[model samples]
Target: MTLHCLPSTDITELPATVSNSTENPETQTTAPAEKSAWKTLSGLLPFMAPYRGRVILAGSALLVAAAATLTIPTAFRFLIDRGFSLPANVATDASASATAMADSGIAAGQVNSVFLGLFAVALILALATALRYYCVSWLGDRITADLRQAVYSQVLRQDPVFFETLRTGEVQSRLSSDTTLIQSLIGSSISLGLRNSLLFVGALGLMIWTSPHLASIIVGLLVLVVVPIMVFGRRVRKLSKDSQDKLADTGALANETLNAMSTVQSYVRENMESDRYSQATNAAFDSAIRRNRNRSYLTALAITLIFGIIVFVLWLGAQAVIDGRMSPGLLTQFMLYAALVAGSTGALAEVLGDVQRAAGATERLLELLHAQPAIASGKQSLVASSTADVAGLGARVDFNNVNFSYPSRPGEQALEELSFTIEPGQTVALVGPSGAGKTTVLQLLLRFYDPRSGSISLDNSAIDSLKLNELREAIGFVSQDSVVFSDDVYANLRYGKPDATDEEVRQAASDAQALDFIERLPDGFNTYLGEKGVRLSGGQRQRLSIARALLKNPPLLLLDEATSALDAESERKVQMALERAMSGRTTLVIAHRLATIVNADRILVMDEGRIIESGNHQELLAGNGLYAKLASMQFNAAEFHPAVEAVRVANSPC
Candidate 1:
C-alpha cells in the first residue's frame, strides 16, 4: 500500500476534531452538525456490503416471523368469535346444522377439519419463528466478524506516525469494546428493531381495519411518544460518546503502566501509578453509571407513556363491549394488536439508542481510516549504479547545510547546517555531547523524518526518491536499546534475517560471542528469552543484537552507541565482532567513548548540531582540537595513545 504524506499539522489536529462534544470540560469536543439518522445508518452499508446475502436471508426470515406474529392475533379473534360464540345468525344456523348433521354424522368431520387448520397455522408460526432466530443470529455473527477484520486490516496498514498520534490502548479499545457494541447492534438489535417496526405497522393496520375510531386514538398517542424519544435521542448519543471516551482513557492508563512496569518499579512509584489508574477507572465507572441511568429513564418513560395510553384505550373498548357496540371477540383482537404496537414502540426506542451509539463508534473508526501518514513515498526507485562501483552500491552520505527540528518542537532546531560525509567502505565515528543531533542524523539516514532544509542521498540517488522499504532494507542498525521479543534465541536472531539458514545464525552468534552463553542455556539455541530478554544480562542482549545485525549483513552498518550498555569484557568481545561486521561495509558509529573509534578512517566531532572538527586521531591530536580534548577526557592517553598513533602511521602513505 502506497501512503501519501499528510501535513504533520493536519495529522496532529485529527484527534481534536474526531471527538463528540466540546461543551463538557471532561471530554474533547468536535465540530457538530445535524445530519439525518438514516444517512448515518446508510454510511455503514459499505461495511455490510460483503454480507449482503446473509442480510437478505435474515431480513426474509424476520419478515416471516413478523407475519406469523401479526397473524397470531387474528387467530385469537377467530377462536373467540367462532369457537366460543358465533354471530347471532350463524349461532342459530350452527345449532340447527349441528343437530341435523349429528343425526347424519356429518358435523364431526367439519369440526375435525377446523381444528386441523388451526393446528397447522400454529405449527407454521412456531417453525417460522425458530427459523427467523437462527438466520438472524447467524447473520449477526458473520457480519460482525467481517467488520472486525476490515477495521483491523485498516489499522495495520496505517504508518507508524499515525499510531503515534493515537494511544495504542485507545485503538485497542475501539477494536474490542467499540466493535462489540456495533456487533450487538448488527447481530441482534438491528434484526429485532426491524421486526418490531414491521409488527408496529402490521398491528396499526389491523387496528384500523378492526375499528378506525380506536386506531385514531392510538396514532395520536404514538405521535406524543415520538416527540419525547426524538428529544432524548440526541442526549443519549452524546452521553454514550462520553462514556466510551472515559472507558478508553482508563484503558490507556492501564496499558501505559503495564508496559512500563519495570520503570515504575525502579522509580518506586507503584502506589502513585496505582492511584492514577484507579482515578481513571473511577471516572469511567461514574460515566457508565450516568449513561445507564439516562438510558433506564428513557426506557421507563417510554414504557409508561405507551402502556398508559394503551390501557386507557382498552378500557374504552371494554365500555364499548358492555354497550353491545362491539363484539367481545373483536375487542379482544383489538387489545392484542394494541399491545403488539405498544411493545414494538418500546423496542424501537431501545434500537434508536443502539443505533446512535453505533453511529458514534462508526464516526470514530472512519476518522482513523481516513487519517494520513506524515511521510510520503517518492516517485522514483533508488537503484544501485552498478555492482562493480563500491560507492554506487553503498551510500556516500553527505549532510550538506542540514537544518532540522522535531515536529513536536517547531520552535527549536535540533540540527543546524550539520555537514559531514561517510565514504563508501569507510567507518566514520560521530562523537558528540548529549542532544548533539547524532541520533537525529541516524533518523534522517533511515528516513524516519526528513531534514527541515537539506538533501540526503544514497550513492548519488536522493534518499527520498527511494522506496522506503528498499532504503531501510539496505541499511543495518544496532541501537543502544536493542529490542528482544519473547521467543526462542534462534527465532530472535532470525528476526533480522528471516531466510537465514541455521548454520548462518550459529556463525553470527559465534562471532558476537553469544554462542558460548547460548550453549550453556538448557535448550541451547532454542532457549526462550523472557519478555524484552529480561532473563539475559544487558551485555548478553547487546551481543544478541550484534548477532542479529551480522545476520542481516546489509552493505551499510549503523551502530548507534551499540556498546554503551556492555561491561568492559563484553565490550571488547562485541567491538571485535563489530570490526569484522564493519569491514567492506559503509559504517557510521555514534560513540561517547573515544577509544572505540580511534582507529576509524575519519572522526567527526559534533557539538550542538554542526561538525566542530574532522580528522584522523593523530592529526586531530597533533592539532590539539576538540577530538583531542574529548580523547583526553574520556580515554587513558598513556595506554591508548600508541594504538591511535599506530593506526595513523599505517594509513599515512606507504
Candidate 2:
C-alpha cells in the first residue's frame, strides 16, 4: 500500500512585516489595504452607465404599463354605474316605465362597449410589460458580462501575495453568484418597485376622491405594515449576506479538495472532508433559514394587516350602501381601489428586502474589482532581442548580498547574504538536502518576489530594473513537478513560445527525446494529455517540460530536480535530453540524485541557506567536505551514470 501523510503545517517563523521599506526596489510594488464596502452601490456606476438609454426606455414602458393597470378600475366603474345600473332618481321618474325599456337597451350596448374598452387596455398593458421586461433583462445581462470580465482582468494581474490570502474558488463564487443577485435586482425588483409605486399613488388618490373617510382609515393601518417591514428587512439583508459568505466557503473547500482528489483519496480522508463540507453547508442553510423566516414574518404581516383592514373598511361601505348614503356602483369602485393600494403596499415590502440583498452582493463584486495588484507596471527601456541575439547579448547573472524569507515564513531565511555569479554558457549545480533553499534561488531569479535586502542583476543591469516579463523571457525553467495542463501536446509545447511554428515545436520535442513517444501515441502530436498529464509516464512528462523550455530557447536554463522522480532507465533518457537542452545555455541544476550533476562545470553544496562548499566534481571529492560526504554516502564511486558514457569531467577515479 502506498503511504500518505499530511504535509507540514507548522510554521517555524512569523509572517513577514507588511512594510515594503526593506523589499528590493526593483521588484517591489505596493497595493492598498482592504477597505470596507460602505459605498458599494455607487461602485456599480460604470457598469450601469453604458445601459442608460435602455434603462430610460424600460422606465417609460413601466410607467405606461402602470397607467394602463390603473385605467382598468375606471372602466370597471363606468360599467357598474352607467352601463349596468342607473341612478335611483332616473328609475323613479314620472315617465319611468315607458322610458325604462329604452334605457335598458342603451345600458346593454354600453356594457358591451365598456368590456371591449377593458380588453384594449389589457392589450396595451401586455405590450408595455413585455417591452419593459426585454429592455431591463437585456441591460442586466450586458452589465453582468462586463463586470465579470473586469473582475477577472484585475485578478489575473495580481502577484503571488494576493493569492496567499484569498482563493480562486472564492473569486469564482463572487463572479457568478454575486453577479446573479445584482441581475435580479436590476431586471426584476427595480421594475416591480417602480410600477407598483405608481399604482399605489394613483389608486390611493382615487380612493380618497371616492371616499376620503374610508381612505383615511386604510392609510393609518398600512403604516403598521410599513414600519415592521422596514425594521425586519434590514436584518434579512444581513442574514442573506452571511449565508452567501458561508456558501462561498463551502465552494472554496470543494474546489480545493477536488483539485487534489488524488491526494485526498489516496489518504482515504473522503468522509472527513465530506463532513467538513457538510458542516459548512449546514451553517449556510441555518443563515438562509433565518433570513427566510424574517421574510416570512414580513409577508404574513403585510398581507394579513392590509387585507384585514380592507375587509373592515368594506363592511363600512356596505353599511353606507344600505343606508342609501352611496350607490352600489360607488362602493364597488371604492373596494377595487382599496385592493389595488393593498397589493402595491405588499409588493413594496418585498422589494425593499431585495434591494438590500442586491446592495450587499454589489459590495462583494465591487470589492473584487477594486483589488489592485502588487506588481503594477514599472517604467523601463529594456527590451529582449530575438532569442538568437540574446545568447551573447546578456546571459550573465549575479546575486549581491541577497537575503530573503517567504512572506509566510518571515523569520526563517531561505537565503542569507548569498552572493554568486554565472558567466554565459556555464553549467552550475546546486546540491543539498531538502529545505536547503535550492528552489528558492530559482524563484528569486524569476522575480516572483524581491529580496528583503540587497539586489540581483542580469548582465550587470539590475533585474528589477527590467520589466518582469522581459527578465523572465531571457530564461527557461523545468521544475520537478512538470505541470501538464489538460490539452493537446501541441498546445502544451506551444505554451513556452506561444507563436512558435509547428516545425519549431517538433524540433524542440526531438531535442528533448520526447518525439519518439509522442509520435507513438494514437494521435501523435495531436494527442490529448489528461489533466496533469496523467496519460504519460514520469519520464515522458519530464521530457515534455524540457521540450516546452527548449521551445523557448532562452540563454539561461534551470532544471530543478528534473529527473529525480524517474526510474534508472527513464532518468538516463531524460538526462540525455537535458544535456541536449543545455547546449549554449547557462544551466543551473538543483538536484538530489548525486549521479545527475556530478559532471557539472562547478557544484555548490548548500546547507541552511548558505553555501558550504563549491568546486568541480574532482575538486569537491578531493576536498572531502559536505559534497564529498554526500557523494560517498549516495553512490559507490560517483563518476557518472553507466547507461551511456558520462561527460568527461576534471577528474574521474573510475
Candidate 3:
C-alpha cells in the first residue's frame, strides 16, 4: 500500500472540463466526445503507478493461477485415456472390467498418480487465486484512498471562484460514489479481465493445435461476436456516464434538503422535497436501467455466439472421435478447452462493461483533481514589518481604485472604485444597506476574489505578490453567519489557533463573553457543539466565532455584523472586549447598527458599491447623508436620549 499525493498545481487555471460540468452538469456530465471511454481510464495510471510492485505481484499470481487452470484439462486427458480406458468390451461388469484391466496390464498406481496430479493442479490454482485476490484488493483500497485524499486536497485549495460553479453535493458525490466505481474496476474487474484473457488465449492456442480446422472456424465466429460487443459497449458507456450524473443529481438534492432541514420544515415543504428527491432518484434509476439493459444485450449476444461456437466445435470433435480421426481423450481435452475459451471470452465481455463504467468515474475524478483556481498566489510571503511587530499593529491594508464583480454576476459590480486605507492600529467602520458592498470590501481585503481592475496591497506590498497563507494569516475574519464545526467547545475555539495554549483559549472565550455558557454546558469546554453548533443559541455561536478569531490574534481584524446575533448586554460586553483588542490593531468593522461604530476612529458610508461619505459618527449625522438616514431610522429623536445612548435597529437592513 504505497502512498502518493497529487502533482502540485498552481491552483489558478480553472480546468475547462470542470468549468463545463459545474456550469451545466446535465449536458456536460460526459467526458469530451473525442476521448473514448477506455482511454479515460488511463488518467488513473498516475494513481496506480506508485503501487506497481503490488501490481506486478498480482499479475504474476494471476498468470500462475491461469496456467494452473489450463493444465487441468491436460491432466484429465491422461486420467481418462490411460487410467479409465480399461478394455471397452469388458467394462459393463465390474468383475469383467477388473479382469480386462489385469489382462491389459494396466496399473492402479498410474491411475492414482494421474488423480494426484490433477489434485495438485487444483491446489496450486486455489493458492494462486487467493494471493492474486489479496494483492489486487489491497491495491484497490490503497490507491482509492490516495486518490480521494488528493482530490479533496485539491478542492480545499481552490478559491471561491472555483466553487461558484460547483456544488458541494456534486463534489461529495465524486468523492464517494465515483471513487467506489474506480475501486471496483481495480480490485475485481481488471484482475478478472487479465486472468480470463490469459485463459482465452491459452485455450484458443491449444484448440488450434488440436484441430486447426475447427479453431479457424471458431476464430472467425469470435470475431463476429466481438463486433457487436464493441458496438453495444459504446452505448453502454454513454448510458453509464449518464447514470452516474443522474445519481449525482439525487445526492446533490438530498444533501441540499437535509442541510436546510430547518428551512424546509418551517415552510412545511417536506412532501415537496420528498417529491423532488423521488423524481431525482427515479431519473437515476431510469438511467441505470438503460445502461444495464444495453449491457445485458451485449452479454446475451456474447454468451450466445461464444457458446454456439463451443457447441459446434464439440460436435465436430465428437464426430472425429467416432471416426477414429482423434482419440476419445483428445476429443475430451478439446471440449474442455473449448468451454474455457467460451467462458473466458464471455467474462472478458462482462469486464469490458465494468471498465467502461469505471472510465466515466475516472474522468470525473480527474476533472476535479486537475482543476485550478483563477486566483494565483505568489511565492513571496508577507514580511514582518517593524510597526506590525508591535504585537497587534503591524498590518496595513490598501485598496487603490479597485473595481470588482463576482464571477457569477459579471454584469453587476460588487465593488466600484473602492479605495480605502486602514492604517496600522486604526479602527474603521463600513456602514451601508444590504448589497451596498460592505461585506465585499472585507472579501476583497481578504483576497477572496481579485478586483476586476486596480490593486490591493497589504503592508505596502501587492496582495497578489504574497502567498495566500501568509496574507490570510495576518488578518482575522468573523463573518455574519458564524460557522462552528461539530466538535468540542475547546476545539472549536482553538480552530483559528491550532497551537493555542489552554489558557489562551479560555481567555479568548472569556473576552468574547462565551466562557459562562461554555462552563454551563454538560461537559464544559469539552461539550460537543453538534453540527454547525446547533447545540448553542445564535448569539452563543457568534461568540464562539469571535473567540476563534480572537484566539488567532492577527494584526488586522475584520468583523461583519459580528454582534448582530447577540443580546444587548452580551453585545456591550463583547464590544468592549473588541474595542480593547482593537486598541493596538488595524480593525475594519462592517456594521448595520450605527451605534456600534459611533466611537470608531473613522466611518465610511457606502451605497451602490462606492463610498458616499467618510467621517466619524457625529460628522456623518451632520452630513445628513446615507449614514445619517440610517441612523435616524434606527434611532428616534423623541425616544432617543443622546446621553443614555440607547438605539434600535432592524435585524437585517434593507
Candidate 4:
C-alpha cells in the first residue's frame, strides 16, 4: 500500500469575487499607502508612550550635556584675555623689580587664574557628558526590548487570517531589523539630535550677542542648507521604503527556498533559486546605493556653503580686531561660537537623513500593527457549563443550510447549502470525490471560517457565541496532514492533552498501537522527532497522530482520512484502535477507502458540497446511489463479494 503525504495549504492567492458587497477594495491592493516622513515619525509616539519617563530622563540628561558643551567655547574667551594678561599692580611691580634687579637678572610672579577656571569648566562638562551617554544608551536597550515584546505578543494573539497576508521572514525582519532601527533612533539619534540642536541654538545666541553682523551671515547660510534638505527628505523616505521592501523580498525568498530544500533538490533547481535570490539582492543594493548617493551630495553641499559663509565672516572679524573695534580675545570667542554652530548644523543634516530612514521603518511596522484580522474574538467570554459534566462534552453539531466560499476564491463556492447532523455517540463517514467539500466540512467544523450565510451550532448554542478556545477544547481532530513539532516523542504525543501524566500518555499510545515501535527506539518516548518527524516512516507518524487524539480523549473526534497514510497491517491496527476509542464518543470520519468505514453507524456520501446519499454501508449499497458507485470503484469485489452476497441472501425473501 502506498501512502501519499498531505499537501500544505497555500494562502497567498487572491479571490476572484467578494462575498460581501461592502468589502473594502483597499484590502485587495498590493501597494502600501503613501505617507509623509513627519507622519511616519509621529506614529511611533504611541509605542513610546509607555516609556515616557525614560524618554524624559534621557532628554534631560542630553539637555545638561548640551549646556555644558556650549560653555566650553565661552571659557576660551576668558582664558585668552584675562588668563594671559597680567594685572596692572603686578605688571608695575614686575617692571620696577626688573629695573631694580636688571643687573642681578631676577624675576617676579605674574600668575593668571583663568586657566584654573577653564580647567574646572572642562572637568564638569566631561563628567556630565559621560553620565548622559550612559543614561541614554541604557534607555535605548530598555525601550527596544519593550517594543519587541509588544509586537511579538500582538502577533501571537492575532488570528491565523492575520498571518495569511504576512510572511514569516517579513515578520521576523520587522521584529529584528526594524526594531533595531527604532532603538538606534531612540537611544542615540534622539539624544544626539536634541543636544546638537541646543548647541546650534546656543552658539547662535552667543554669536548674535557678541557680533550681530556675523550672526546674520551664519543664519543666511543655514537657510540655504535647509532648503535642499527639505526638498530631498521626502524622496529619501520613499527610497528607504523601497530598499526595505527589496530586502524583505530577498529574505522571504531565501526562507522559502530553505524551508523547501527537499523539493528544490528533488527538482534540481538550486541554480534557478540562486539566480532569483540574487536578483532580489541586486535590487536592494541598487536602492541602498541611490539613497547613499543622495545623502553624500546633500552633506557636501551643506558643508561647502556653511564654511564659505564662516570664512567670509571671519575675515570681517579680523579687520575689526586690527582696527581695535573688537578685542583679540572677543574675536577669538566669536569665531569659536561660529565654528560650533557650523559643526552642529552639519551634524543636524546627517541626523535629518537618519530620521527619514527611521520614519520609513516605523511606517512599515505601524502598517502591520494596524491591519485587522479576518476573524475577531467575541465580546462575551464563553464558560463551560460544568468542568466535570460529560453531557457538556457531547456537542450536537448541525450544519444548517451552510454555504461557504473560500475567502481567497470567492466566485467559486467550496461548499453549497450543505446540511447534515452527527448524532452523539454515532460514527459517521463522509465519502466524497476531491474538491467535493470534504475538507471544507472539517474546516467549518473546526471554525477556521464562518459560513457565508448559515449557522453551525453545538448543543443548541451557536458556535459563534462560544469562546473559540472553549469550543475547540471539546473536539479533537486528526487530519491527513499532522504537524509534528521538533520535540521528543513523549512531548509530541502529549501535545493534544498537555496536562496528561506519563502513565496516561502511555495508555493512549498503547491504544493507538504506537507503544511497541516507540519502545524500540533508542530513547523510546524520549527520542526527539527531527523536524516534522522526518525521522519516522509514514505509518509511524500516523500512529503517533492517533496517539495524540487518544490522549486528548475529546467527546467529538474528527478523523480526516486518518488511515489514508497507513499500510495494510498498520491500517488494521489503527482501525481497531479507532473503533475501540469511538465506542462511547461522537466520531466524524472523512473516509478515502470504503472498507475502513464500512461498519460506520451512518455514512453520508457527498458530492460538490451537497449530501447526496445517507445510510449505513449495506443500506447505501442496496440503494445503488453515490455510495455504491464510490464503493464499487474503491473496494475489490472478489475479496468481499461472497460475504456480502451471503448476508444479502440471508436477509432476502425466498
- Scored by lDDT, the top model is 3
Q: Which one is best on TM-score?
A: 3
Residue-level lDDT of model 2, residues 1-654, one tens digit each, is 001011111111111011001112222223334323334566777888977899889989888887888777667776676665754557566577437636566545666778888888878888888888889888878887898899889878777777776777777777877877777777776777777788889889999998999889888877776777667776767666666766777777888899999899999999999999999778777877787787777767777887899999999999999999987788888987887877777776677667666776776666668777655444453454233335453277788988999887898999988988887778899998888888989988887778899898777678777877777887899999888889999999999999999999999999887899999999999999998899998878988998999999888888899886677787777778778777677889998886788768889889988888899888888899988878766665544456323433324566
Local distance difference test scores for all models = 0.74, 0.76, 0.81, 0.74
Q: What lDDT does model 3 reach?
A: 0.81
Arranged by lDDT with the best first, the candidates are 3, 2, 1, 4
Deviation in Å, model 2, residue 62 alpha carbon: 1.9
What are the per-residue Cα lDDT tens digits for candidate 4 across 66-165?
Answer: 6766776677776566444443444456565455444333222312344566566667666666666776777768877877787777777666555556
Over 4 Å off, model 2: 1-39, 89-111, 201-224, 308-334, 384-394, 636-654
Query: Comparing candidate 1 with candidate 4, which one achieves the higher lDDT?
Result: 1
How high is each candidate's TM-score?
0.85, 0.84, 0.92, 0.85
Residue 591 in candidate 4 has what lDDT?
A: 87
Candidate 3 lDDT over 254-315, as tens digits, reads 88899999999999999999999899778777877888788888888888888888898789
Candidate 4 regions with alpha-carbon error over 4 angstroms: 1-33, 85-120, 379-389, 636-654
The TM-score, computed over Cα atoms with residue i paired to residue i, of candidate 1 is 0.85
Candidate 1 per-residue C-alpha lDDT over 1-654 given as tens digits, one digit per residue, 9 for 90 to 100: 001111010111001112222123323223246465566656668867877777777777667667767776777776666655533443356577576546544456666776687677666656665666676667657765776677777777665455545677777766677666666667666776777788889989999999898889978887988888788887877777777777777777787889999899999999999899788778777876776677777777888898899899999999999999998889999998988888787877777777777777776665555555566677655555324134433456777788989875779888998877777788998887898888888888888888889888776677888888777777889998988999999999998899999999999999898999998988999999999998898889989998998898887889999998887778778888888878878899999877688778998888888888888777777778777777666544434444444544554577
Ordering by TM-score: 3, 4, 1, 2
